[model samples]
Target: MNSLSAFHRPLGSTGLQVSPLGLGTVKLGRNQGVKYPNGFELPDDRQASALLDLARDLGINLLDTAPAYGISEQRLGPLLRGQRQHWVICTKVGEEFENGHSAFDFSARHTRFSVERSLQRLETDYLDLVLVHSNGDDQTVLDDQVYPTLAQLKREGLIRAYGFSGKTVEGGIRALEQGDCAMVTYNLNEQAERPVLDFALSHNKGILIKKALASGHLCLHGEDPVAKGLELVFAHPAVGSAIIGTINPHHLEQNVATAIEVLGR
Candidate 1:
């Protein structure tokens, strides 16, 4: 019940196993244009490296990063050098952030280029997972060439699996039908995506829950809201992993402990 690795589960039928909690690296790479309840500073290389070390020791293997997360992908490359096999990296394409602004490119060319760039930045020959970073218009983004390009990459051995980080129920279902997984926002404050989780459960597809703590906003309420929120997230059978974006080592440890307790029960 204490070791997170012991609770690792299959990510649908992707043949890849991930811990109950994945580390989300947005705060490690970017601090601007975020929706957290409070402001924070980016961690230095030493601090970030230590955080990764702690995460590994706690038995978390899934690391979620993206091009839109400022220089997160780039920083993770150097920080995670020589330890690539110890982790399951899940990155995204389609969305890119620059000058504090965001842009979307779901075209076939960009999708292909993004995968290669992510490979270069992560210092890996192949990526464990690649998701299409939807621009809130989930259905429209899926209708583009992004999904098909990811499929091609998967077949080419560039990526082990591909999916969509979408915002809609229909999009999540469509993603699972066409790919291996879907990342959706499922937290205490948001249950609008429950249908997506239901579909994933019925279809036996992978589902990654984003904003499980409501970007830390849920903590503003009653006691131990983080624990309550995590309880709600892990209560679902479809959740392959819940991505928690905590840069604080103490917070990370507490989150993992809470998850172990929840999963144990």
Candidate 2:
């Protein structure tokens, strides 16, 4: 298959096809130092806008963001107004940011409000995908509020698909068991999530690999360690896509080239 075709994969049973390499927008919104290394301050709006344009031009169709990412959806939505239809905009609910810290809020009412607010910020009538952002605890939240709320949104057509962006392997596994979720994002460097990856693959769940470079530590010593690590993850039969955050368009293009080279190998 060609690079674009290789990049495209089924997002669970949602029937949505997205690129294998996605753009993570937290850095673009000026929320750094959370999950990434050397996370220093983010770039200004003009630079972020240029990066988004570059990503689209390079065929990146999935853009992952979260409300906790501090003004990401608000800024990205307006910049992507003309090209919104060309990409899959993925955002999360259940995690809120205050004072630059993230907190979980999975109450049914809060979940509903989060989705609605995300829609408003994104300037879209419906979300391409909505994930319940979990911080490794509160499995009950998924059972009690998240699942039902997501189902309701899907039924109402306010969301095309829903899933979990979890911090733990067990939480991800549980989310997959619901069988209604369209995709799951998990830390790939930690083997703890391997079982969840297997389950998702077996069931055809959309699998997006996060932290594939282990928060930039994989290549800390240089020599393209991150590229090698990503090669392994992409070769895995289960992983559908990997989200890499970078401020420079040249770095993005280099990573894409590396992925293409590794896939060919």
Candidate 3:
């Protein structure tokens, strides 16, 4: 199969192009309080760099990270030095990870602070995209305070686009109504947020899929569950990219190949 770069598509109305799959970097920062099917040690710098090289060679350009993912942003900052233009970096605000726990703050002040911190952590003057990390209270998270703050940041050119990584279908719809994109969970095991995807498709907004492989829990005693799961996700034309968090090089290659095969690129 060819590289995914050949199939890059517009990320809604954001004026940015992205790959069909994004690399989720939660494993690069924290190995604690996760739901992965297998335990893994955090890769060292050399190993992490090698994985990134493999991802770029595979034509994956989108990178998903968040402050709630421990030090993922911190690590990516140095790792991505001098190659910022090649990536469509998507990070989050409103949630923080510390002491093996997660905390949420959607206030305007914290929102600005979080964005600035991410800029510094990512070692970039501008972020390609910034998403609000929802604490499950989607309505409250889409409140006037934090959402507007992100909009202001976009206007100020600190971020190219802004949206919410929401938990509810209603919140996902509302987020797209006021922002550039919305991240939702849609997979074989869960379709509760399918309405959100439909809205994005109808409205020409961006949709990023989380837990596309059910966070690595969809492995069944059958033939190629990964391919089956990816087939279901790619069935939605609104899906801008599905974030896969696998750190294994072989799995990454397989996923890229599967995406290429599914899309027939």
Candidate 4:
């Protein structure tokens, strides 16, 4: 098996390429006191920004963040200001939060407002991709509000592509069948979404795997679980990238090195 660093795949048919291992910034912002087995500390804004710079330096180009992740967009946006062209800045809407609690708000107006807010926060004119951040089982949100708003954004040139983030396999398949989304992020370790991954592969939709290590659960019981789990996902013909979060540059370097070794790049 190849090391984790060897994986770089195209994100859908959008012509945007990304490392198979991308940086997920949710934990970088505020983990909300969530504990990881590695005892990893969540980095503050300065530290997170530095980590992002280092990740980019290491050849990780895709950075995923969400408005729901308290101040993540607010923090990541500024750090990414001048390097917009060098990386894929992907953010999400439909989820809102205050005081660390989150709620779904997929209304068209909210979606529009969210994009504007993200642009303002990130200090960028356009986002590479805007995902409908659904918590699974929100078909009404996808059918009625999410797609329509994203369509408008694409028409207006505010976003390059749009897709959905599913917490369940059924929801992922539903998004793929709808035929408007360019990519989808599905949970790989759960294995509940393999059929969805297969469907996405058949349709040529971009597939990004999330929780590939089951939020570090897999890592706790084994050595280099992130490396192993990512290898499995990258081997899957459908997967385009895997988004993993870590505040440690050492860990991030390990991820990139593993990819380079595994993918033979």
Return the TM-score for each candidate structure.
0.97, 0.91, 0.98, 0.89
Q: Please write out the lDDT profile of model 2 over residues 18-65, one tens digit for every residue.
A: 877889888766554476556466777788888887777776888999
Clashes counted in candidate 4 amount to: 11
The digit string of per-residue lDDT tens for model 4 on 23-104 reads: 8887766667444665555677688778887887787888889898778888877777678888888889988877868788
Per-residue lDDT over 96-167 for candidate 3, one digit per residue giving the tens place of the 0 to 100 score: 989988999999999999999999999999999999999999998887489999999998999999999989
C-alpha lDDT of candidate 1 relative to the true structure: 0.92
Q: Write the per-residue lDDT of candidate 1 for residues 1-265, one digit (tens) a residue.
A: 2459999999988889999899999999999999998899999999999999999999999999999999999999999989998999999999999999999999999999999999999999999999989988988998899989888999999999999998888888888999999999998889998998898898888999999988887854457887898889989999999999999999998999988888888
| TM-score for candidate 4 | 0.89
The top-ranked prediction according to lDDT is 3
Write down the lDDT that model 2 would get. 0.77
Clashes of each: 0, 0, 0, 11
The order of the candidates by TM-score, greatest first, is 3, 1, 2, 4
Which parts of model 3 have CA positions greater than 4 angstroms off?
none
Residue 228 miss distance in model 1 (angstroms): 1.0
Candidate 1 Cα errors over 4 Å, as ranges: 220-222
For candidate 3, which ten residues in a row score worst on lDDT?
Answer: 219-228
- Ten-residue region with minimum lDDT total, candidate 2: 179-188
TM-score of candidate 1 on Cα atoms, chains taken together: 0.97
